[model samples]
Structure formats: structure tokens, C-alpha cells
Target chain A: MVDDEELTPLHPNHVKVLRVVTALATLPFVIVALVLEVRAFLFPGAFMVPVVLAALYVVLRIPLRRYHARGYQMGEDRLRVVKGLLFRSDTVVPFGRVQHIDVDQGPLERAYGLATLTVHTAGTHNASVTLPGLANETAMEMREAIRAHIRRDTM
Target chain B: MDSTAPTPQRTNPLGMIALAAQGLGKSALPLVAAMFGLRDEFSGIALVLVALAGVGGIMAVLAFLRWHRLTYVVGAEDIRVESGIISRAARSVPYERIQDVSLEQTLLPRLLGLVEVRFETGAGGKDELKLAYLTAEEGARLREVIRERREEEAVAGVAQEAGAEQDSPPIFAMGPGRLLRFGLFEFSLAAVAVMGGLAQQFDFILPFDIWDWEHWMELVAGPGDWIAHLGPWAQALGIMLALASLAVLGFATGIIRTFTREWGFRLDRTPKGFRRQRGLFTRTDVVMPAHRVQAVQVGTRFLRRRFGWHSLKFVSLAQDAGKASHVVAPFAKLAEIDPIIRAAGFEPESDTLDWHRAAPEYRTDSMVLVGGFFVLLALGLGIFVNPLLGFAPVALGMALVLGEQVSWQFLLHATDARQLYSRRGWLVPKSTIASRVKLHSAEISQGPLAQRRGYATLLLGLAGGTLALRGLPVERARALRAAVVESMTGTDFSELR
Candidate 1:
């Protein structure tokens, strides 16, 4: 396994994507906090301060931490992906073992010109490994590289 | 066998009789109960017989319709099956994609000289194609045709020779005497549990509530009074007799089940692969190619290990029934198993290979986490409930901690150039050996506590099964991952033996 410092970081625009996704997720809790405030349940700041603080922590602080936590290494014939803070998973998928490859872009990711690359294998466990937060062009290049490797070996 | 005209054909017409018989058997009990309930209204035994015949006639007609609707076509490139009466559905499986073909025969089918042909596509479960109640000769011919087509597609230039029927002698088999001994180790109490459940389900038919202790005591009062007068020694003897009977029942059940399942168990090495045939009532014949095997497992119970008895299984892409692994040798010594393992292109672990135990900190962390939970539980019980009850939880917690320690001692893993071997558990130890080249991917995962403790788990992805080495120091986990990845990437899987 490569050290954390050696891994190449994801495109910087991924941080903005993460922030927008987090904000959207926190919208429900923010609505609940407002409803409680309007109904005057308990002290005025009881739920409001905690909800705002939590939402700010998730929206502002988490994206950067998560961005820093995720990294990937493209070797000659294998791809290594490492991510997560509390529950880290480091995976290696050999180019020859990849059954298929997919490059996907969600609405937010498309806006930021980012994509997610997924590698599928035949194994029942960990059959598919997805590495999110990549430049769309870079994702396409990696997919082509893997596809070429498979084609050369099969031939 | 080469008649690939693509003509749709139905299975043996006699299959309708077997199907109708099966349907009637399923509804026989309910039908009889209904007949008795309406006996007074009809006022004659002849009327009840007429109703029974009517139901059986309906079932026979339905069976005929089902048989008529189902048809299969053996085509040049693929085998197509079109079924359903109201809305037609057709499925075509290419010959190159079919992994293997198997044959099965139940009592009725066997009596009718028919067999069920199955085309396994390595997809597992109901996805496999099944053609039931084909004539035994047709079934055998179909299996050979599909196998020949698959081989021709696999290797385009090489022409396979015909009539290569000199199969190797039985690699492993169980005789009656050996099966009897195996049954002794398989003593189970499941039969008693099923009987108890059935009794509970029909307790309303009993005069009194069987669950009531007072009712039981009342029923046993006469015998109980006599036994009491016979003194304490006699009462102890009675209790001993009751326990002895339970043990006898358990042994009897185990022996009957073992005899039925392993009556003609035989494994042979054919040119295509390992051919296995077994069962007393519902015989099954399955052939698995040697190269399709992804891993091998050797398992033994605590007591069985002492007697030098172990079981061997092969993990393959094609499912055996619904299970991912097929038992090759259910009961055998290590010496008997070694040859089979070699035949499957795997070797037993060598003594020179390095073995590594899980990190000590991993054990300590779990003990602290689990022990803390028990301590909280004990305190809650002691403060609000009886203090004596709290002591029980404390003792249980100590026992659990000790169990974790014992298990941790047995948890270890090793890797050679060709295979990764992992052994876990003390009571029912299972050793898994997976081919490194066959592994799809490698992963090192860590939970929050593990991240803080500097330990991680390594998971090697295998088709149809799992092979994981848990609780290793970060450095060791990384080393294992690198080793596995090296083997996985270094080889061209298309050329693997």
C-alpha cells in the first residue's frame, strides 16, 4: 500500500461538489429546526443553535476533510484507491481482472466536470470498486488504459 | 447427438403422470380432511370417492397442459427454451457460456427411465436451465452434445477425440461401515425438536393444555406417587432412563439421515472433470471442471479433529444446488484428502511456510469493548435489581472474554506463492486455501477503533466464496495486499490451468 502522502489527490473541484451535496443533505434537518423554532418548543436557541452548528460542521468542514482523506494511485497494470476517515478502505484492482468499467457523472458532478470511475470484477465480495472525485477527462483516460490492457492480453 | 435441426421437442409424455402424482400428494391431507367434514352431507363413502377422483382428474389435466406448453430446441449456437401457456417466454443460452451440464433423477423419474438435464451457466440459483423428465438416453446425449460444442468454442482449432470413455477409478467413496461410523459423529437432536414443534402445533386436539405444568403433574400423579414411594435412588434411575431414551432417539435420527444421503456416494475423475454421483432416493450427477474451482476448504469439528476425521469441499463458480461449495469428501482422513486436493491442482500447506497471528492489541481492544458493555449491564442490574443477579452477568462476561482469547489464539493466516491459507475458530475449525491468481481484487479495511489501534483486515475477493484475514497490524495487512496484488496482476488469467 502506498503512503497517504504519495497518493495523487482528486481534482480540486470535487471539494465544491462535496459541499453542495452536503448542503442538500442537511436541508431536511434545517427545516425541522425552523419548524421547531416557529412552534416555540422549549427555549428559542435549544434546537436552533445545535442544528446550525451541526449543519455548518457538515457543510463547511466535512467536505475538505473528506477531500483530503480520498486519494488514488494508478500503477502500470493495477489501480489502488484509498478513502474514508472513520472507516477506511484501501482497494487494488488489477487491470486484467476487471470484467467491465464505467464512468458516471451525477448532476452535481457534471456541473463541476467531475466523474466517478467504477471497476467491476467477477468476485462475489467487493465485486465493484468505485473511485469518485475524478476529472472527467482523467476518468475516461483511465478507462481506456484498462480496456487496452484487457484487449491486448485477450488477443 | 449432432442432429441440430432446431426442432422444438417436448419431454417424455409419461412425465405427466409423475407430475400429477406429485400434485395429488401435496394436497392429499387437506383433501381427506375436507372429505370427512362433508361426509354427513353426502351420506355415503361412494360420494367421497367421487370427489377425490374429480380432484385427481383435474390435476392430471393441468399436468398435461403444463407438459404440452413446455418445449426446448437444441440449436446450432444456443439452446432455447420457450414456455408458458398464456404468455410465451423464450430463453436462449449460448453453448460457449454454459459451464457444465448435470443430471438428476428422483424416484418417479428413475422408475420412468427419465432424468432431469440441467445446464449450469455459472450464474447460480434458478438462472440455470432445466429440462425435466427427458428420457435417460436423450439426457445423456444432450449433455455430451453441449459439452462438445463448448469445448469446440473454447479451443477453435483443436479437434477433440471421440469415445474417450476410460474414466479413472473412483477417487473417493464411502462404504456402509464407514457411513455408520460417520453417523456416530453426526448425532443430532433436530428430529426431537421437530416432533416437539408438531405436538405444539396440534395441541388443541389434546384434552388439556400440554404446556401447563399443573396439567402435566395431574397426568403423571399415579406414576409419580409410585415412584416417590420407591425412594430417591429409584427416582434418580427414572431420570437417567429418560435421558438415555433422548440420546438413543438422537443417534437413531442421525444414522437414518446419514444412510439415506450417503447410500451410494462416489466421486470419479472423468476426462472432462470430477464427476460426483450420490443419494438414495433422489440421485444427482454433477460434473465440475478442475479449472473452474476457485478455492478449497478443509473443515473439522472439535471432536472429529481428535479422531482424525475431516471434510473436503471445492468452491466453484457453478452452484451445487443453492450452495456455492460442493462437498468432495464428506468424511475422510487427511491422508485420503491429500490426493483429491492434488487432483484439483492445489497442494496442502507446507510446514516451511510462515504463519502470522492477529495483533495482540486487536484482542485487547475487543475485550475492553465487550467487557465494558457487560460491566454496564452488571451495574444496572445490581443497582435496580438483585445484586446476586448482577454476579451472573459478571461471570458471563468473564467467560466471553476467555472465549475471545481462545479464538484469537487460533486465528492465523499464511500465504505462499500460489495460494493464500487462513485458519479460524477453535471448536469448528475451517481452513480455506484460495488460489492467488484467481483472486479478483484485494482490500485492506479499517474501522474507527482499528484505525486508532493501527490494525486492519485484509479481504481477498474470490468468486462464490469469501477469504479474509482479520485483525492484522497495518504493516502486515499492507504486505499481504501487495503480495496478493502481485500474483493477481502478474498472470494472464486466460492461460491459467
Candidate 2:
């Protein structure tokens, strides 16, 4: 983590966002599994442990660990995003290669005055690297800075 | 919405009519079906006409509103688009980032004497900016302007980079004979695969009962007929002959399909770019500028590689569907492929060789991955039904894994003044070369096996594609990743090398 300390942590509210998104995403499958559990012919309680473990991981462990683990750095000419605790990935994108930059806010983000900055490049894998849970103003400033770099590089 | 916005542009008014027509077509089938099935009074000519007119008018109005709301402006250095009916959004793509502006005219647009102008930005996902309908002349004008700008940039790029602007003249064109040879060499089993899939889906396609011996006997010869007079060995020989004929038929069909597509195939150099004209009936003509090209890939099957034959493709941002990635060189001799690579302004240090071999770990990784996949299949089958056949698959997998280990001897990487190269694989070995300038992002990933082997997979992401190089030593991978990131900052667009 101390390779270079330009890393910026996401907002604390991001944990709440992650939890809600995970709960909503898992809701449908859990409901279906609950119904299936009653009629299941083979082992009646076979799914219970796996289901509970997955739910606990999704709702509790993941959002907490992941939120703390994720950090991004915005330089004048490049952006570095460090993510994942167990399967760690450090992604760096140059401004010259960035085709465009956008500051996007969803309804939840809007409520918290938070936004995510997505930097798009020509790359297929890791093309649109999104840095979520920045202050709305910070996201806009980052977008402008990246855009400025892009414009300057083009010229 | 702002009046101060400069140089606002809109699609042709006829686009509204076309949009309405499209909407009508989508709903027409269901509307017609329900009207006939349920309503007697609606079947009247006057009533149907009135209803149709009403729907069409509403559609036309909606299209007009959308047209009115959307506007794109060609700025000094950016193309700014403002759109959306209820919620407004403005997107500005700088001219430098614009890969290509292509003009497409499908049936409706062509019939209307209009065109669709698409701007390909070398970005992920929603990479295309489309202006649905414009007058043919307007579309052409936009395309020409973008091309001119790109040409200027290329010249400027070359001049600033201290490289001479060398535009190689018309190198080679595929004659009909050459095209025929190219077509024949391409081992496309898509046709046979489709037929086989359909046969399995609908068993009636298979004329004879495959399992029943009596049914097969009837197919070969009626009971007490001439084939029955022949021995069982003769019947087996007849079946072998039938299989051979089927194989021959599949091969011939594939050849014919290739000929149809490459009938008028032509590749020649234009003043500022490369021009590829092919297709028998559709007659596609694609113009690829040198700078717009992200990477060059040369591929060849194991059999074709023995004969010095290979296929080449250009990874570009152009939305030339079906033709986009399968381009640069469809199928040709390695001798023929070299010039195209050079023509694209990427000349490797040594044309024929000087490829850096991969680390020894590559062999071990390839063995584990490919062989592991096969062994997993074997294990699955063993658990389900047969244990005896599982041993054979496992043995075969081991042999194949050994072959893959040998293939690592051929795994190579190279870098020249302009590009980075990676050549790997044995079954369908491919050589990939990308301009150093085109590299945007990169990552290092390690799986459980890689972690144990003390190596990591390096993924270099360019415009429109990603190249993954596995089994690099952990330290080397880290160094390469850092170097890549450093080079991205250290070098300017012109000084890619």
C-alpha cells in the first residue's frame, strides 16, 4: 500500500451504498432459494449454510473490507486506481490515452452529494475505470483536470 | 438549451420520417395480427387507414421533438453534442481523440438518399457517436473533414517525432486467382457446423436411423438387394466412402462461400491511407488511416503455418461490423503480410526474426491451463458415467500439455522504434504488434498457479483490444508494469518508442 502514497480513499458513505446495492442484488436469488428450500427433494437444509455464508459475506464482510481496500490517485498526467484486498489490482491510465472523462452521479450518490469519475480509454479490458464515492465537487474537479490534460496533450 | 452554444448542427428533417417509419414497422405486425384476430370493424379499409394515419402522425411528432432537442456542434478542436428530451447531457470529444468518422448508408438511409455518420472514439463500451440521418453530401463532407484533420495530425506527428512521413505506394492488390487461393486455404467449417447443429436440433435432416443396423441396411441397400449380396466389409467400406464424400462436400461448400465474399477483393494504398474493397454484392470499401490503426495482428493455424501462410487483422476503432477486426490482411503468405505491417507505419527491427523468447514458466502455465481444462472435462465424464474413457482423455491431455510446453519455445516478444510485439500459441499461433503510442493502460494479475510459479500475467490494454502475456517473473512483471506507467508519462504521443 506504501508503494507511492498518492492513494485517496473513497467516502465513508460508499459503505452504505455498497450494502444497499448488494442487498438488492441478492434479494431475488434469496427469495427463489427460500421457496426452493421448502420443496427441495434431495437434502432439505443443504442450501442453508451456503446461502447464509454468501449473504453474510455480501452484506457484511465484502462491503466493509472492500470499501477500506479501495483507493484512487489522480495525477496531472495519469490516474491510478488500487482495488481488491485478496485479489489486489493496481490500474494506471494515462491522460493522453483517455478518450473522454465523465462525472456521473446516481440517485443514491445524488442524495449524498457524491459522484464517480469514469475515465474511458481505447482499451477493451479495464477501458472505463470508474473511481466511485468522491465528493460531487471533487469528481467535477477531477473531470476538469483530466479533460484539461487531455486537451493539452491533444494540442 | 443555451442560446450561446456555438455551431449547433442537426440531422436531416427526413430522419424524422424515417424514425416514424421504423416505429411503425416494429408495431405493425402485432397490430395487424390483433386487428384481424379480434376486431371485425377495424378490418374496414377506411378505419384501418385512419388508425394508421393517427399512429404515424404521433410518431412523426415524437421524432420531430427528439430531433429538435438534439444538436451536435463541430468546434475548433472538439465535436460537442447536446442531447436528451427531458434530461440534458453534453458530450465533447476532442478531434485528437476521434479515431475515424465513417459514413454508412443502409437500405432505408440509402433509399432516402441520406447517410449515417458515426464517430468512433477509441473508448470502451459506448464508443460510437452516431448522427442517424444526414444528406449524402453532408455525410461525405463530415467524413472528408475528419480525414483531412487526421491526415494533418499524422503529418504533424511524424514531423515532431523526427520520423520521415513515408507513405508506401500501392504495394499489392489481390488478383482473382490470388483471391481464389486465399479462399481455398481458409479452413472455415462454419457452414458444416451450422448444418450439424440444425441436424441435431431437427433429427429429420439425418435421413437414416444412426443406431439401428436394419435401418442402416435399408439405407445402404434394400433387404435382399445388391448391397445385401455384398459382404459386411463392403458395407463398412461404403459407409467410409459416404463419410469421405460428406467431408469433400463440406470443404467445397466452405470454398464457395469464401469465393462469394472475396469475389471482388482488393487491397491498395490511397494517398493518405490504406483502402480495402471487397464483397461481391454489398461492395464494401473501407479507408483506414495509418494513425487510426491501434494494432496489427498476424495469425495462422498449425497446418497453414507449415506452409508459410497466415491471416492479418488490424485492431481499429472503426465500426465496420463483420469487417473491422477480420481486416488488414484476411489470409495471405507471410511474404505478403510483411508489407502491410510496414505500410501501417510500424516496422519491426528485423522483419523475419529477432523475437525475444518468453520465460520458462510460460510452458508450465500453458500446460496447467489448457491441459487442466481437458482433464476437468475428463473428470466430469468419469464421475457421471465411464471411468475407462477417462484414462484415455487424461493421457491425451498430458500429451497435449507436453506439446504446449514445447510451444513455449516459440513464444516471443519484440519491440522496435514504434511498436511492441508478442507472438505465442501453437494450435493457432498469432503475432500481435501495437504502436507504443496506442497503449493506454496495463495490469499485472496472478492466479493461484501463477502465485506458486512465482510469475504474473501482464495485460497490456491498447485501443479496442487487450494483450495478455502470461508467466513473466514477478519482479520483471512489476518492473514492466512500473516502466509502462512511467513511459506513458515520460513519452509524448510522437515519441512513443
Candidate 3:
């Protein structure tokens, strides 16, 4: 039945992690724009610096919106992940179908005490569904839960 | 030799020769081309001959080293393969993990009574293990041993009977007459294209410049002059005759291609599962277990539909020659294909299905999007290029829009208690029937426009292939997802086999 259950958001620290990543990714373009503005190559104006800053400011705020857009609902025997703004995707993976579970941490995620949980299924497309930005402990607990479910089903 | 013992055994000794010969054959084309190009220079010819000899020697030595190093041990729990002259890499696959075992025989190996055995693990292409040039008898025995071992694991303490090899009556077989008709529908002009490409590639060998219009004119003058003198009616007749010949050539090429590919095609239901054997020059024998099949696809072309002909393919965990789905019946009447579909534990689609069309808003939005793009192109062309040329795009756009409407009419989806069905396409209609229990996951996706239009696309995850039901109302999409997830969670997958 179509139950309207609110999805649980990621750890609050993930927003800080996303913000740092966004700024790091945008640093190069900001520097390039500043250099071009100082050189004043083809077009002579003080507009390039201001335009680049405005773009950077707008992009730096996307991480928060992205974090807000992503959420997950762990059902009794299934996990539902909803994400994306422009192109929303709601995926449901039943515990019975999961082939394996993984809890991995990237450099930034480890720094923020966050990890990514991935569930691999036997299907070719969408064979692995990843839900990132979970507290490291939570990720491990979820992995154990799914593993127990798989073991019980096999038994 | 004990079959079940963990003794490492080498493949047939003759495989060394076969591997070397195969390597040489691969290089023969370039070697011959180089020799031809250097025919005028004595030193160049000598260089090419020496190079050929060097390559042949290296190939022979490498093949011998490879055959010597490679060995397989059919252990009780798993099959281990060790190879790589310098690296010494060894890999083992447990019997339970092997999805299927297939045998292939190219011309040279067939003549030598050898077959290439492939063990598919359902882990994609790179994971499959292959043993080349084994005796045909040995290959078959090995396949049986693996099958029995897997079955033993699936049903503990139940020993399967061995060496039965009983020939069951084929469920589907294509005779010469049936193949001829099928070939007629496959008319193609690829041979003409191949000839043109060859002529262009080796134009230097021609006495005249093939691309020079003057040369072609001169060559045709003899025939052209005579036709001109015969009168206008005779000229017209000659042109008609030439067109007819081209059509005949296309049909002949198609017939030849089909005959070679589908010669002696037969499909049988064995205790192991479905066994398909086909091909004229390079025969292949593949067996797919019924439980490994995730879905069934029934497809037909526009003309074939009118003739009641359809093709049946199985979306199985095991890959078929790099393809996601295995062709069970390439060309058969619906009546004939129905039995095979049923044999695979799938029911043929009946007229009583509660088919639902895609949301009206989705169709309208798509039409407007497609039509608007074409209209803009037409405007740009009319303003920048010739107005007459612009009219062509507008006409093309109109035709495309009409096609979209027709396809939308045919796009329907339905679901029964055990299966999910989706049918799409107008010219080449394809209907997929997937078992709910076999589905790994369900995804509901919506692009920006679809979100505003209140429709979503539901993609069902199958093992080898994917089944998508597009343009469903968002409410219905969620409902379907709930239904599919319920069915998936209710079943115990371990009991499938």
C-alpha cells in the first residue's frame, strides 16, 4: 500500500563534508577566472571576477540542497533510497535479493566519521545500490543486519 | 583416471597444434597483404617472408609453452585452473557458482574432433573460464560431471543418474523449407557494400582508377551505346532488368547468411535444462537451466507479425556469445514458440490481460517536445539555408511525430500474480514477461518534465537484462513497486533451484 513515510536524512556532518568537497572542486575554476580577469585578454572589463564569484557562490550552496534531497527508508525486509533533484530516483532493494553488503570509507568520509553502505544484487543493471553519508557505526550495524537476514533466509 | 579426483590434467595434446595454427591464421591476412604490396621489390619480399617465418615460430613456441603450463583440477568442492607462463596465476570456482557449461567448435577444431569448453559463472564476461581444444567426448563428460555436482549441491544427498545421454525429441527444429522462408524475410544488401569496400581498399590492383568517372564511363560505353541505339523502350526495359537483378542479389545474400548461421538448428528439453545446437561452420552447444532464466522476451518485426512469426529469447543469468539474452527460437510461428515459452515455466500472453496504457499527459508532453525540436530546426534551415531544403525537415518531423503517437498507442504494461509484463514498440514489438520472485530490485525514476507531468518510469532489475515500464502515473508506479517488492520479499530465493 502507498504509505507516505518520511525518509530519514543523512548524518548532519555529511553537509559539512559535502561543502568542503564542493569548495575544493570549485577552487581551480575560481583561480582561473581570477587570472583571466587580471590579464584582461579579449574583452576589457571588471565583469569576469564578479561573474566567477557569483557562479562559485551559487555552486557552493548546491551541496546543502543535494544533502536535503537525498534520504533513505530502511523497511523491515527492504531498503528504499530516494535521491536527486533534477532527476529523482527511488530505488527499493529487498533483503532477500542482496548478494553482499559493503561498508567503505573514503578519505573525506573517514575524516568526517562517515561511510558509504553498498548492497550488491544479482541483477545486471542497478546491481549495486549505494547509500552514502551514514555514520560509520550505523553503516556497520546496517551491514550486519542485512547479513543476518541473508543468513537466516539461507538457513 | 577418477573423474571426481582432484588430479590436475592437461587438455588434449593436439590443442597445441590447433592453437599455433589459429595464431598463424589470424596473421595470414596481413602477411599476404604485405607480400602482395612488396611483390615489385625483391628485398621487401624477402623481408616479409622472413617476418612471416619469425611470427610463425613465435606463435608455435608460445602455444607449446601455454599448453604445457595450463592445467585444470576438478576437485570435489571446486574446479581450479592454473596457467600463465610468467605470472603463474591460478583461479578456482566452486561448483555451486558455475551457472552453465557450453561447448563450441570452430572448423579446424571440429575436424580435429575437439571442442572449446566454457564455464559461465554469471559474473559477467571477464569472469568466465574457458578450456580450449579438448576432445569432444571429454568435453561432454566434463559438462555432465559439473552439472551433476551442481545438482548434488542444490539437492543434498540426491545423486543424479550419469551417462544416460538419451536423445529427447526436439521441441523446436528448423528444416530446410522453414529456413528458406525465414531467409526470404531476411533480405539484405550487405554483400554489395562489402564488395564496394573491397574494391576501394585494393583499387591499386585494378587496371584502371576505380573512382575516376571517365574510366567508369568508358567501361560502360560499350553497353551504353548499344542500349541507346536499341531505342528508348529497350533502354527503359534494361534499367528495370538491372533493378530486378539488384533485388535478386540482396535476397541471395540474405539466404546464404541465414543458411550458414541457422543450419541444423535444434532446441531440446533435457534434464539439465534447455539445450540449443546450431551453426553450420562453427557449431555451438549451450545449455541453460530453467531456474537461471529471469524473464522471457517475445519479439516480432512488422512483416513477421503479419505472418504470425515471432522470436523467443531467454533473459538468463548466463551470457550467450556476449549477448544478455539467449535466442531460443530465432524464427518460429507463434503456435510453435508458445510451447517453448510454456516449457520454460512462462505462460504465453493472453488477450485477457489487464493492459494499461501510458498516461495521456506523458504522450502529449513527448509529442510537443519532439515536434517543437523539429519545428525549430525547420525554422533555422528556412532562414539560413534554402527554403525547399527546410520543408524536408518539417515533413520528416511530422512523420516522426506520427510514429511517436503510434508507439505510444502500443506501449502497454500489466502484471499478474507471479509475473510482470511490459510491451513496447510499433514496428518491432517486443513484450517482456519477468517473474516477480526473480527481480532483484525496483526503481522509480522521473526526469524534470516527467515529474511535472506526474508520471514516472519503473525499471525492473533482471539478472542479465532490464525490463522498463515507462510513463506510468506516479501513484500507479509506487503501487506497482510495492506489489513487486512484496512478491520479491515473500519468496525464499534459496529454494528456487
Candidate 4:
């Protein structure tokens, strides 16, 4: 799914948060296997070993790949977000159609000094295009520029 | 902030009852399920009352919080709403960006002297920022304020561009008599499908259930082995005849609903935009401003096509009575539809347009997309049940593939400087005319195979929804995309907003 043009990649540290989230997701399966082993069921190693490998593969490989795959660009009057590795999609949001903008930071994101900038548009398809794993300062600048552009466009 | 006027006021307290009543109705099923499982049939009535009270009380509290949290502030250049009970989100809609402020009143709300205000900002799906409980006067005042703001913007726009103002007069009216005629041809496959599904689910409850599948299956089991008394061809014929009759029955009921919904249908063109007043009992009114219109579509179903009748709908920034689009002239001659499209700012093209056909590859793509379903179904039925049934399906699938090929021959799309034109579909051909200025966005996509074939599907998203022109050469799609984007670059959307 590689394209001719190289896009602006996401922040490198995003893979760390994604890894943690995916690790927590696989915790239940590991717990179930541990319980089964303690109960003297057919050795949990049989299922747990493969499950751990799969979970580890998913957590370690997928996040870094996805992080590298995600990218966004600020066009003259429209915002372009291109993402996905296998099923790639390119979304364009014209400045005229934008209703609002939001900069969001979760606890994990805040700790990393990263934020996600979302551009809200009127179109049903691609209603809100989010540019994730941005430096907090860059996110603020983008948010301000979007608001200023909206004001200028209205005038 | 404006204490003198109190712009944002609570709705009539009676609206709380209406809210509670709606909540109670929604919760009644679950409450009954609980009582039924408890096996206390005698205490059902008491349980229902208690449950209803619980629902009502919860709704009343939520409604009060919602009302308390909701407030509209009309600023000089913007209108701001501070809403969400817990989240406390603030949304500021610039004055020029607000598309339409829709006012609605249902029976209960109307009786309670309360109305709902929906602020639409041209976002297609769920465009509403709704305040469900507003006093009737407050709703009217809010609408008036927005109207005045729009007028000021329009006046300023007119100063820049002269002769920019236009109005649509009453072009079509469907009286009670015409509604009856309209209902007769309202029969669609969707109606049959819905009725068929409902009958399948609830047939056992009916006293006289002619559609009882179990009884029909038992009767069709046939004397001795299957197909002993009746031949396979005869059995097939019987099934076909029964299906045709069921379709006819469904259409009959669909006609009734059509009559009820469009009894008082009326369409008129005002200086500002197109207005539709319809519905027999509810009497809904919708106004679509001329500038706000996104695209105009002229459609004809198979039945209506035979009669040279067409329906015209407009995709506009304003929500059309919370529907996808507004049906300006539901059932009319092409002569009638032409003028309506013209009013939406397009010179109506001739019926025999020199359309640009899709690439020849579309025939194969469509066959795989559509005929593959029939082929798979046939294979499943043949392998799982009867081998003879398999041959019929293969033939049918081949026939479907043939149909797709024919449809592909007719699949076309073209664009001029002012507008984009596309005529698609085999069974129910729909011609769409979208103003280049109203173009929302464009997308070009190709599968791995299609990329190799050098063809892709180009989707032009307008106010009217996406118009997909499939099987265009990759170069053509890219060129078309560039052209559309160029046209959309500096297009002023003040009107649509």
C-alpha cells in the first residue's frame, strides 16, 4: 500500500502509548490462561505460549507500523489527512466547510506532551479528520491558524 | 449575560410531561419483560404503573438538567450555545455560517405551547444542534433573529453582485385527487420487502394469515415423495405465482400510506426559496432557500418512466423535515420537473444527452459486484438442498451478468463548466445535476486489479450525496478531480452555509 509520495509521519512516541493500550487489551487472555493452569487443567503453556506470541506480535509490530503509516498535511485552504497501511484513504476538508476545530489530550497524551487536532467539517463523509500524535505546541498553532482562517474566510 | 431580554428561556413546564411520556413509552417493553419473567401476571398492572413512574421521574430530572444546561447567546457576529449537562461544551456558530434554524412542533409539544429549535449548519448527517423544549414565542423570536441576520448578509452580498436575488413561485400542487393518483403508482420493491418481512415475523398472530409459510410448506410437501404429485416446473410456477400475488398485496397497502402522507401536499416557490407543505394529519412545512440548494436530482422509477412522470428533489443545506432531501415535485411530468431544476440554477439538459460512457471494464466489475451474489446463493442452495435448483441459479446468474453488461453500456457521467451531469442505474434510471459551485469534495479510488487496468471509480460528493462514476480511466478520474477541485477552490458558500 506504499504510495509514490512520502507523507508527514506521526510523532515517534505514539507507538509507546499504542503498545501499552494493546498490552492491557491482551491481559485478560493471559489471566484466563493463568487461572486454567492453576486449576490443574491441561497445561496453560499450550495455549498461553501461542497467545502470548500473537499478542506480543500485535502489540509490538502493529503500533509502530500504524504510527509510521499515519500522516496529515495542511494545504492552502483545505486540510488533508492520509492514513491506513493496507486500506489507505485520503480525506480533504475545505476551509469553507469547517465548522470548528478541537485539540484533545488524554492523560497519556498529556504526559507525553502530545495532542490530537481534529478538524470538523460539514460533509457527512470525513466529518471530523484527526491529526494525532502532534506536539502540544504544534497542535495549538494548528488550532489557532484554523480559527483565524475561518474568520478570514467569513469576511 | 443579557438579563434585560432573557433571550434563552425555559420551555413551558408542561413540556416535561411530554418528555416523560415519550420516555415511558420507550421503557414500557423492558418493564413488561421483567414482570413477565417474574411470573406475577396478576401484579402486572401495578408493576407497569411503578415502572412508568420511574421512567417519568428519571426523564423529568434529565429534561430539567438539559433545559438548565442549554442556553443560546446571539452575538453581533456569532450565535453561541453552551450545552451538555456534564461535558459543558460551548459551540459558537458564526452568523454567516448558520444555514437554517428549523422550527418544529409535534402534537404533544404543540398542545403544551412548546416548540423545538434545530440549528442546521449544512453538515449532512445529524446536522441538528437541537433544543427540544422552547416556548412557542421564544422559538419564533429565535427564528426571526436568524432571519434578520441572514437578510443583512444577503443585502451585503447583493451589493457586491447585482441581480443576485430570485424567488420560486408555486409551480406544482398535489391536491387530494392528485395524491390518490400518486399513491397508485407509489408501489416499490422496498414496500414489498418490508411487508414480506413483517408478515414473516408476525403471521402467527393474525387470525386469517394467508401468508403462513409453515402451512404453505406443509401443503407443498406433495403426495408421496417431493415432486411426485406435481412436477418441479409446476412447483416453481406455483412459487412464482404466489410471490407475484404477495407483491401485489404489499403494493395495495403501500398505496394507502402514500395517500395518508401526501393528502394535503403543496409546493410553492417564494422569493427566498422553495417551500413544501404536505402531510394529511401532521401538516409539515419545509422551506429550502434558493442559495442553500446543493444539487437537483430528477428521477423516474420504472412505473413512472412508462407514464413519462418524474420526481424532482433538491439536496440543500437546510434539513428537509429531517429527511435526506426535499421532494419539491414528487410526481410530475418532465415538463414540470425541468422548470424546478432551472429554479435551482441549472439549464435543464435534453433527455437524449450525449453522455460519456464508463470504461468497458465496468461490465466485468459490475458482474462480479452484483451477479456474484446470485451465483453464490445458487451454489449454496444447490449444494445444501437440491442439485436441480443449482442449474436454475447458474442460468439466473448468467442472466444477471448480462443485465449488468447492458447497464454498463448506459452508465455515463459528464461535466460542463457550470454543472456536473450523471445518469445511472438500469432498472430505475436517475439523472443528477449538481452545480459545480456546490461541489463538496471529490474522491478517486482504485482496487489493486483496477489500478492495473488503469481505471478507477470517481466519486463527486455534493450537497446531494455522492455521485459515483465508476470505471473511468485513472487519468480521467485524476483530471476530473483536479478540475472539480479547481472549480471549488474559491467558490463562495455563503448561501449554502
Model 3 DockQ vs. reference = 0.69
- Interface RMSD list for the candidates: 1.9, 3.3, 1.8, 4.7
Model 4 TM-score relative to the real fold? 0.67
Q: What is the DockQ of each candidate?
A: 0.68, 0.31, 0.69, 0.10
Q: For residues A45-153, what per-residue lDDT tens digits would candidate 2 score against the true structure?
A: 6766578678878898678988998888877678888777656666778877777788899998988888988988767777788889888998888888877776563
lDDT tens digits by residue: candidate 2, B137-201: 88767766666566575546543321122243345556677766666666566777887777778
DockQ of 1: 0.68
What ranking emerges by DockQ with the best candidate at the front?
3, 1, 2, 4
Q: Give lDDT: candidate 2, residue B29.
A: 71
Candidate 3's C-alpha runs over 4 A off are: A36-61, A152-155, B5-7, B28-58, B84-87, B157-166, B386-390
* Colliding pairs, model 1: none
After superposing candidate 2 on the true structure, give the runs of residues whose Cα lies further than 4 Å from its correct spot: A1-68, A104-115, A133-141, A152-155, B1-169, B187-224, B230-237, B322-326, B349-390, B447-453, B490-497
Residues B1-497, model 4: lDDT tens digits? 34235365454567667777667667777666655655564465676676556567777797777667777677776777787889988878776666767666676776777877777776545545667777877776676677667778665554323123224336787777677677778765676678779988987877766666777677656552466466888778878998998777767766778876776677766655666766644445566778767778888888778878788888764566567778888888888778778877776876555578877775677788677788888889899999889888788888888988888876888887877888888778888887776776565666666766668777665654666778887677777766776677576444455
Candidate 4 chain A weakest ten by summed lDDT: A1-10
- Greater TM-score among 3 and 4 belongs to 3
What fraction of native interface contacts does model 1 preserve?
A: 0.80
Q: Over 4 Å off in model 1, which ranges? A: A1-5, A41-46, A152-155, B1-5, B25-48, B156-167, B206-228
Pairs of residues at least 3 apart in sequence or in different chains that clash in candidate 4: B168-B269
- The worst-scoring run of ten residues by lDDT in candidate 1 chain B lies at B159-168
Better of 1 and 4 by TM-score: 1
Candidates in order have lDDT scores of: 0.88, 0.72, 0.87, 0.72
